[model samples]
Target: MACRQPPLNSKRPRTLLCHDMKGGYLEDRFIQGTNTEDCYIFYHWASIDIFNYFSHHMVTIPPVCWTNAAHKHGVAVLGTFITEWESGKDICESFLSSEDSFRAVADKMVQIAEFYRFDGWLINIENLLCPDAVKNTPIFLRYLTDKMHSSVPGSLVIWYDSVLEDGKLKWQNELNNQNRVFFNACDGMFTNYNWKEEHLQRMVAIAEDRLVDVYVGVDVFARSEVVGGKFETNLSLQMIRKYGFSAALFAPGWVFECLPTNEFHQNQNKFWNLLCDYLPTHSVSMLPFTTSFCQGFGKRLFFRGKEVHAGNWFNLNAQEMQPLFVDQKLAGAGGSWVRTRGCSEDAWNGGCCLLIEGALVSEKPNVSVRLLSLLAQASPRLFISFIYKQDCSDRVRLALEVTTTNSCSCENSQITTPQDHRKGTIPHLLPETDNLVSQFKKQCDTQPVEGWTINCYLLELQESFLENVFVNISRLPDADAKYKEKEEPFAFRVGEIRILDVNSLFAAPVQVQNLTMCNTLWRRGFNDCKKRENQLYLSTTLRWFYPPNTAVNFRIFCKGMEHHQSVTIAESEKMVLIGRAYNRVYRVVDIPIPDPPVGTSGQVEFLVQPITKEGFVGQSSNCSRLVVNYLEKQ
Candidate 1:
C-alpha cells in the first residue's frame, strides 16, 4: 500500500513518540466533554488482577493497523515507547546488560514510524524517582534523540516530567526538564496531573521562553473517546492549552470495559505514554500529593460534603502506570456498585472508605448534586455501593436509562425509545436501566434511619446512566443532560464508588467462601504479608455454568479476603470440594462469575465435568441451571 503524503499546507510539526508498552489505537468516541471533540484514549493502567509481574520489565508494541484504515480522517497517528517502574534502577538495568536490546527496540521504532507514518512522537520520560534517578536518562534520551533526529527531524518528542508534582520538591522533574533544555531536546511534555496551576504556568512559560523548541503537554484522562470529530479528551487538552499548555492522551491499558464486543467499531482510540513507554505516570509526577482526579472506569459521581458536584465516567491513562509485580485477583463482581471518600483525618479506616460514598461529606448546608452518564458503546449495569448516614438530609437515587441522538429527525432505537414497563422495574431488552430510585425519598424521620443502613442494590436497565433530578425529584436544574440535558448540580453525601462492567464477571473465577475470618486472622499473624492458605468456598450463588456428576480435574485459586486480586493459592494445587460424594461432582472447573454477576464478591472455581464418556450427560441443562442460580441472588 502506498503511504499517504503529508499536506504541504499543514504546519503541525511531525514528531516521534516512544512509550513503554503497546496501546493499539482505535478510532472510537464513547464520551463527550468540553474540547474533547477531537480526543481519544491511549491507555490507562491495567486492573490489579489483570496486570502483574511478567508484563512489567519489557514489552513488544504492535503497530496501529486499525488507525491506518481511516483514509479521510485528518487526525494524526502517533505511537509510544515507555519505561517500566519509575525506579531508575529498572530503567538502567533494562538497557545496561543488553545494548543490542536497545538497538533492536530503537530499530523497531524506526520501522514502525516509517511504516505507519504517524503524526509525531509522544516522547515520554516516565517515572523519575528524583533528579538523581533520571540524571543519566537524559544521556540516553539525548543519544536516542540524536539517532532519531537524524532521520525524523520533523518528529516531535513529548516528555512526561515527574518531579514537579504537588509535593516533594524532588530533583527529578527539574533535572529532566533542565536536561532536555541542555540537550536542546524534547518538542514538548505532558504536564503532571497534580501540579498547581502556577506550576503548570511556570512549566509552560519555561518551555516556550527558556527551552529553544519545547511546549507543555497536558495529559487528560477523558471520560470518553470521541467528543466532536475527535476523542473527548481533546476538549481538556484544548482547555489546558489555552492556558499556554499543550496536551496528549494518557492511554487506558488493554480492554475497553465500557464497550461491548458487539460495538466493536473502535471509537475510543488515541495514543498515551506508557511506563516502559517512558516511565509510569505516577512516577512522572512533577508535584506532590496534589490530589487530582485519578483515572477510573465506568462512571463517576463527585460529592463535596453534602452535595453532588459533577458526575461522569472516568477515562483511564493506562500507559502512565507501572505493571504490578504481584497483582490482585479479579473479584467476580460487575461494574462498580459503590463509592465513598473519607476525610484525610478519618479514623474509621484508611482507604477502606475509598469504596464507600457519603463518608466524605462535611457538615454544611446541602448544595448541588451530580449524576453519572452510562456508556452506550457497550451494555452497562450500574451497581452503586456507598454508606449513608442517618438524618443526612440527602436522598440518593440510583436510576439508569437509555441514551441516543434524540433530535426530531433522528430514528428511535431501544436506547432512545425505551418501553415503559412497571414504573421502577428493569426495562427488559431496551437500551435502558432499572434504578434503585430511592424509596426513602424524604430525609429520614429518625436517627440511624431505616435507609441509612449499609446495603448493596442491583440496578439493571436497558436505558441510560443519567437522570435529571437533585435528591429524588427528577427536576434538578443542574443535572447533566444525557437524560434530560439540564446542567446543574445535585445534593449528595458520599464516600467512594465501585463501577464494574457486568460482563467482566465472566473472566473472574468464582469466590469459594467467606474470607472475612481468614482476613482478620491474616492481618494479625501473617507478618503484614497477609497471604493466606485456604481453599475458601466460592459463594456459588451466581455462575455461567455448573457441572454435574463429574470426576474431571481442576484446581481452586485462592487469595486473601481483603485483597481480591492477589492470589494466595499455590498454582500447583487448585481443586476445590463442593457438594456431597454421590451427587457430589468433583470435576467442575472454570466457574466464571455470571454475566452481570450479583452480590458482593466473596472463593474458588473448579473445573467440573462428568466422569461419563457419554458426552457428559445434561450438559445443556447444566448450563441453564447455572444461569438460573446466578439470577436468583439475594
Candidate 2:
C-alpha cells in the first residue's frame, strides 16, 4: 500500500526499474553503493498473490526492503496491480461493471499503497476485456489516479503498455493513439520491450513537454527481444537517449543469475557501468558511513558466515549492511546440538550472541566470516571484536586473514600478488599457530577468568591494499582423541565481528594549509596570457599533514554560502592515501565557484573530509577541520 514518501525532483531522464525476476527477490545485489541517478521509479511486478479485486490478498505489495532502499536513494517505488488470464478477466469485469465497483477497487489500491509505504501502483491489465469493460477501463484508471493523487500528493500510477484502450490484450511497444489514452490517465507509461528506434522517436514527439514520462523498455536478459544482452546493454540506453526518452531496464539480475557465483560482483559492475556510460551522474550529497555485523539479530538464511533475512533482502543499502554470513547450510545429519554454558555478548551493539551448539566440524578446514566490504579502502589500523566461550579441551582456534586481490583462490601465496583487482575474492591464509593462541590469550579472558570471554584483536596491515579480510574458526588437529569415548562435541558461541577504525583512537588530529588557485593557462611566464578574460578556467591545490601512520584519502566539498545546508558539491576525486608522517598536495580541477553571501566578499569556503577507501566518512572528525577560503578574481 502507500507507505512510501515522495522522492526528490530529478533533472535526469527517468530510469524506471522493473523488478520481475525470481518474484522480486534478486534486487538485493544492487543496494551496495551503486549509482542510481537515472532510477526515477522502481516497479515490483505482479500483484497476483491472490485473485480477489477488493481483497488485500490479491494486491502484490512491493517488498518493504525495496521500498526502504529505493526511497533512501530518492527514488519512488510502486507495487503492481495486475490482472491476467481468465481469473484476471473475471476480476476486471467485476471491477469495471459500475462506478461504485470502480471506486471500491481504487480505494483499496490506495489503501494498500498507504499501508506498505510505497509511492504508487502499476496497472497491468494484460487480459482481454469485454466490450463493456473495455469502454470503462479509462474511466476506472482515471478515477484511480485522481483518488491516488488527492490522497498521496507525489504518488504515481504507471500504465504498463500491455492492454490498449479498446480492451484488447495487444502489446503496443510504442506510445501511439491506441495507448495514449491510458498514458494521459496515469503518471507515465512503460513502453513494452521490442520497440524500434522510430517508435522511440514517435513516443518522444508525443511526450514533447513531459518527455521524461516515456520510459522505453530494455530487457537486459530477455533473450528473444533484448539487443546487446550483457555488457553491451549500453546500446539500448544510447538509443533511448538519442531520442530524449526515459529508459526502463528490466531484469538487471541477469548479471547474478547467469554469471558464476565467484564472478557475480565483477559481472554486476561491468553491466551497470555500461548504463553509467549513457546516464549522467546526479549531484546528490551522501552522509558519512558506518557498518557493523551481528548474527541472530535479524537474519533469514546462513550460508557460511553470510546471513540474509528471508523477506528483507536489500543488503546493498548502507544502513542494512550487517548480519552477513559466508557459507551457511542446514544442520546436516552428522550435526548434533550440545548444551553450552553461556552466549557470547555482542561487541558492537550490546545484543544476544549467536550460539554454535551442533558439531561444526566438517570436511572443510575452517568456516570464515568476510569483513572486506567493511574494510575496503579503510585505515590499516583495524580492530575485530567478538565473544566466545571455550573450555580447556576445546580445540577451536580463531584466525584472521586478509587477501589483497580479487582472486577466488584461498591460497596465501596467490593473495599477495596483484592479479585481478575486482571486488569479490576468496579468504586466504590463517594466522600462525603460535600467534593465534598467544593473541587469543592476550585479547580474551578465558574460562577460569570468566564463563564467556570477549576477544578483540587489533590488526595493522603494513601497506594500503585493496583486499578481502576474513575471520576463520578451525578445529585443532590434536584434540579429536579426547572426544573419542562419549563423542562430546566442543561448542562455542560468537558475538558480533566489530570492525573498528583505530585511526580515530589517536588523540592528535592532522593539519591542513597552503591553499592556492591556478588557471588552465597558468605558466611561469603566462601572467600576461590573453584569452577571453571573462571565461576563466580555475583549479585549486591544497596541502595537508597527518601524523605518523595516519595517512588517509580526502575529498573536497563545496556549497553556496546562501544555501549553507543545501546539497554539498563534491569537487574533487579521492586523493590517494598520503605517505605516513608526510605533507601531501591535492589538486582539484573544474571546481564550481559558489555564490557568496549578500554582504560578503566574492569568496567561497570549502570543507575537506577524509574518507576510507570504501568511501566511509566518520560522523565527527578526529582529524583537524580544513576549510579553504577562495577569493574571486577581480
Candidate 3:
C-alpha cells in the first residue's frame, strides 16, 4: 500500500533515524547526494572471509573508509550478522559450538571489528530462530554478548525483537522474564516489523525515560506481508522520538540485499536524503539490478534481438537482458542454442524474447531464459532505446530498476521541498543527531554498549556475492583453450552460486578449506571435521565457459611448491595448481595459479583445490594465493 511522505524540504527534520539504504551491503559514503537529515544505520555483515579481505585494507584505510566518517556525520555503523536459520532451533547450530570454533571465529570477528573500528553488530535474531530455534536463542545471545563484551565492553548489541522494559517506560528489559534477562544482556533492542504502534510507543517511552537507548527494526522487503503500512518508510529522528519512537530503521527493499547497485534508488536514496539531514555519514545501498542488462521499451518482449555475453565479473543475481529476444537468440548466432544441464528450467534461463519482420530476421535470434530461482530477486524494468553505430544506429538496449508494485511511487510525490525562507520547526535543525552520536561516542570511550536499530533486521552476509569454486565449465589444459571443441579462448565461468551462512561466529568456528579437482568433478574446500561434514558443503553449477581440449602446461604458483609433482586442474596434465590453508583458524587459504590461458577470458570460481595430505602442510589465509591467469600463445 502507498504511504504518505513528509514534505521533501520541510522546515525541520522529521522524527526517527531514517535508516540509510542497506538492503544490506553498503555503498561509498560520498556517493550520497540529498538534503533531508536523519541518523544513518550503516549495515555491514561480517564473516571470516570478509574480515580477512577488509582487515588488510584497514590500516591504510582512513576512518571514513570504516565507520569514522559516518560517526563524524552523526551516523552509527551497525554490523549485522548473517547466520544459519537452524541455530535458532537449537544451540548445536551455534557458530561457537566448540571451544576451538568459538575462539577462532570470535577472535577474528572482534579483531576485524576493532581494526575497522566498527560500532556493533546489527544482530540477525530471526535466523537464529528460523526453525524451532526459540529455545536456544537466548543462550546463544547471552553467549554471543559475553564473547563480544569480553573483548570490547559495552559493545552495543541491537536485538531484532524488543528488549527494553523499565517501568514508566524506561529501558529496563521489562518484557518477558526470560526474554528480559536475555534482552537486558543487550544495551538496546529493535522491535520486529510485526510490532504495532502501542507496543512501539511503550518501547519508545521506555527508551527515553528508562533505557539508555531504543531502536526499531524494519525488513528489507515484506519478509511476510508487513502487518501494517508500506515496509521501507523513513521518518526523521526527532519526529520519531517525539512521535514515541526512539529511532527508525528505514531499510530498502530486497533488491538492496543481494547486490547494492543503482536500481535501489527509490528505497535507498529516498531514505538517504531523509536521514542525511541528521546523521553525518549515512549508509546507502546500490544493489545490482537485473535492469542493468536489459534495454527495451515496456516490460514485454525485452532484449528481443541482441547478442549478449556476461562480463568477467558478472553477478548473475543482479543481471538481466533487454530488447526481449525470440527463440533464435538462445540458438547462438554462431550455432549456439539453449541447453540445460541440471536444475529447473527457470533456474537455468535468465529471460527470453524475440523480434522479427514478416520475412526478415533482424532481431535477437535466440533468447536465453533467466535463472529464476532465488537469484532473480529484482523485478527488472525494460527501456528500449537506440544507439548510433557506424552506418546506421542499432537499438542500444538498457533496463531501469523500477519495482514499485504499480503503487507506492515517489514520482509526482505529494510532498514538496519548501521554496520560501522559513523558520526551522521542531525537526528542521535537529541537533539530536549530533547529540546522540556524541553521547554514543562518550559511552563507547567509557564503556561500550550493545548496539541497537529500532524495529530493523540485519543479516551479515559472508561474501554478499557468492565466491565459491566452480571448475570445468570450459576446458582448461595448461594455457590453451578451445570452445565448442574448436580452437577458442579458454575461460573459467561461474554458474549458480551456493552460499553458506556463518553468522554463528561465537557458536561454531568453521574450517573452510580443502579443494579437489579431477576429471569433470572438482571438489575442494570441504570441511573435514566429522560433525561438520554434513552441514559444510556449498557449490554452484559450473557454467563451463572453457572447453576442455588441447596439450599445454600450466602452474598456479611455482614460487611456493613443496614437491616437483605440482598440483593441476581437474583431470588433465594440461592444467595444474595448488590450494593450501596456512592458518586454519583464520579461514584463510590460497588458490594456486597456473600459466595464463592463450586467447580466452575466464570467470572467477569460488571453489578451491585442497592440498592432498602428501602435497603441502601450509596454507595462506590470503585469497591472493588463488591465481587465475592464462596467457594467449605467449
Candidate 4:
C-alpha cells in the first residue's frame, strides 16, 4: 500500500469534486467485477485537482477504482469520514469520549488510507456535539491532520463547514469565527453550499495567504439556496474564481443521476465543459508521456487492435491520461470544427480511443486541436510515436509544439540525454523561432496491428524541455474537389501515443509472484433462464508481488478452463478483463461460474500483466498467473 505516485503540490486555485450518489456504496464497491453495465465513472480528472468519495456512511473509503483512475491522471483522491443524525451522535460519543479514543480513531483513519493507497480524508460532522466532544473536536482534527501529513507526505484533511464550536449543529455557510477554529486545525475547510457572494469575500479575508486552501462548496443538485447548480454549475465556479477561492463541487454526478442515460456521455462533457474554463489547468511533467485518451469504459474491450471481450464494461482503473479537448461550441462559427472525446465503439488499443471528427468547409481548410499539456524535459535525442486510424481521405498531421528554455545547469542531461548514438539520427539543431519549436512526423510504413498506422518522429534537444503537443487535421488539396459547394467530412481515432527518450531502453517488468486469494465470499444466484437453476458467484481479494518501480499499472485478466486441463492453451481460452490494479492488491466481485452446471467444478486462471507508465505492456510469457478451483453448488 506504499504509494509510488507523487503527491499534489500545486498552489493554484484548485477544484475538488465530491462524488455522492444515492447511498454509500454500489457495484463500484466490488473494485473488480464481471458486471459490464454502464456505471457512473468520472472522466474529468484533468480539470479537478482532488476527488472526494463522499457518502452518508460513518467511514466512507473510496473504491480502489477511483484512486487508480485519479492517480493515473495526477489527481489526488480522498475518502470521507462523516457522522450525521441521531445514530451519528452515539458514534461521536464513543470516538470522542476520551482523548485516547479520539486519537486512536484518527490513527485508524491513517491506517485505512495507507492500506487503501488513497490520498486523504474529508472529515464531516453534522450532528450536534456534546460539551466534552466539542472540546475534543479540534484536538481530533489537529491530530488527524498532523498524522496524515507525516504518514502520507502530501495528504490532506479538510474540515466541512458545519457544527459550530459551541456544540450546536449550525451551518455557517462560510469560514467565520464559529468554524475558523476547525479550519485552523486542518489543511483547509469546505464551506457550506448555501454560501453567498459576501460569504466568499469574507472567507477569503479569513483564509488570508491560504486562500486556495478554502474550497468554497457548490452543490450540483441545486439544493437549498445553492446558486447555479446542475447544468449551470459554472456560475458558482466563475464566482469562486472571481473571489480567488478554490471550489468543492458536491455531487457532480447529477448528470448521471438526473439526466437521460442515453445522453449521459455528451451531457457529462457539456456540463464539465461549462466549468472547465473557470478551473485551473494541470500538466503532465513525467517523461515518456503517453495516453490513448481512453475514458476507461466501453461497449467492448480490445487489445492491440483485436477484440478481447465483447460486452459493455466500465472500470475507472483502466482509464488513461485524458486529453484537454477544445470545446466544439467554442471551436468555430460552424464553418469547420473538430470535436474530440473517447469513443468506445472502436479502438486500436484498450477499451476506448480519441475520436476527432469534424467538417472542413471552403472557409476553413485545416483544424488544429491542442491535445496534451506537458512539462517534461526534452532529451538530447527524443522519439515520439503514436497509433491512429484515418477513416477519411483528409490528411492529419500530429506535431509537438515545445517552448523550451536553457536552464542554469545541465539538469536535462540527467533526465534524457542520449547515451547510444547510432546512424541516421541527428541532434535537434533546428533553431527555435519565436521561442517555439514544432516537431512533425509523417505516417510510416510500420503497421504493428491491422487497420492502424504508426507515426514516429525523432527530435534531439540541446538543452530544452517539452511544453505542449498539438494535432492538426487538414484536407489534402485535390484538383477535382469542389470545396466551395459542400463541406467535406473528416474523422480520425488516435489509439495510442508515446514520447520517449531515444537513449532509454524499455525493460519489461519482472513477473508477478506470490499470487494469493483471500476473504473469499460466494453467493447463490439464478441465471436469466426460466428454469431457475442455481448458479454460484464469487467475490475475493487478490494479492501478488512484483519488483518495485517496474510498472505503473497492472491489468488483471481471468479465463475459465476445464479442471482436467493441465496445459494452458491460448486460442481455446477466452481472456476476460476482470479489472485493473494500481498496486499489487485487487478485489474481484461477482465472478459468475462460466457455464455453470449442477455440481460440476472448473479451474480459473488469473493473469497479471504489468504496463509501464508510457503504455508499454510486458510480454504475456513474462507475466505471472494463478489457477484456482471453482466449486459449483452441490
Q: Which stretches in model 3 have alpha-carbon errors above 4 Å?
A: 1-76, 82-108, 115-117, 125-155, 162-178, 204-212, 220-232, 235-240, 248-250, 253-268, 274-634
**Cα lDDT of model 1 by residue, 1-634, tens digit:** 1111222112222221222223332222211112221223332221100111111323323233213221112223445555544463366445533556556555666666566554344444344434443443444455555556666544444455543332122333222444444335444454434443455455554555533232333223333333211234334434344453333333332223334533321332222211212211111111000111122222222221221112223222111111111111112322212222222211111111111222111112122122221112223464333343332223333333222221111111111112321122332222212223232111111123333333333446554422211111122232433533322223222232323234332222232222111111111122223353332222332222234322221122222222233223234543322321112322222222222223443222333322121111222222221211112235
Instruction: Provide the TM-score for each candidate, comma-separated.
Output: 0.30, 0.45, 0.31, 0.82
Tens digit of per-residue lDDT, candidate 3, span 1-634: 0001212112221122223343322332321111212212222111000111111111222223334323322233446544423443243345435555544554666676566665455444333332223444455566666766776543545554532222111222223343454455555555555444555556544444433345444444445634322332433243344444334343443345543443443344344334333331111111221111211111121111221222111111112222111122122234333221111011111222121111111222212122111121112211111111111112211111111122221121111112211221111111333443333223212222122111101123222221111011111232322222332221111111111121211122112234323223223343444333322221222111111211011112323211122233332222223211211211212332222233553222333322211111112341223333222243
Task: Write down the TM-score for model 4.
Answer: 0.82
Residue 474, candidate 4: C-alpha displacement in angstroms: 2.4
Which segments of candidate 1 are over 4 A away from where they belong?
Answer: 1-60, 70-76, 86-88, 94-108, 111-136, 163-183, 209-235, 252-634
Score residue 513 of candidate 2 by CA lDDT: 40
lDDT of 2 by residue, 543-604 (tens): 55433323324444543323222233234432222111112444554443333334443434
Winner on lDDT (1 vs 3): 1
lDDT of every model, 2 decimals: 0.29, 0.50, 0.28, 0.73
Candidates 3 and 4, the one with greater lDDT: 4
How many angstroms is residue 622 displaced in model 1 relative to the true structure, after the best TM-score fit? 55
- Candidate 2: which stretches are off by over 4 Å? 1-11, 24-58, 283-634
- Judge candidate 4 against the unseen true structure and give its global Cα lDDT, from 0 to 1: 0.73
Clashes of each: 167, 26, 164, 1
Candidate 2's displacement at residue 179, Å, is 0.9
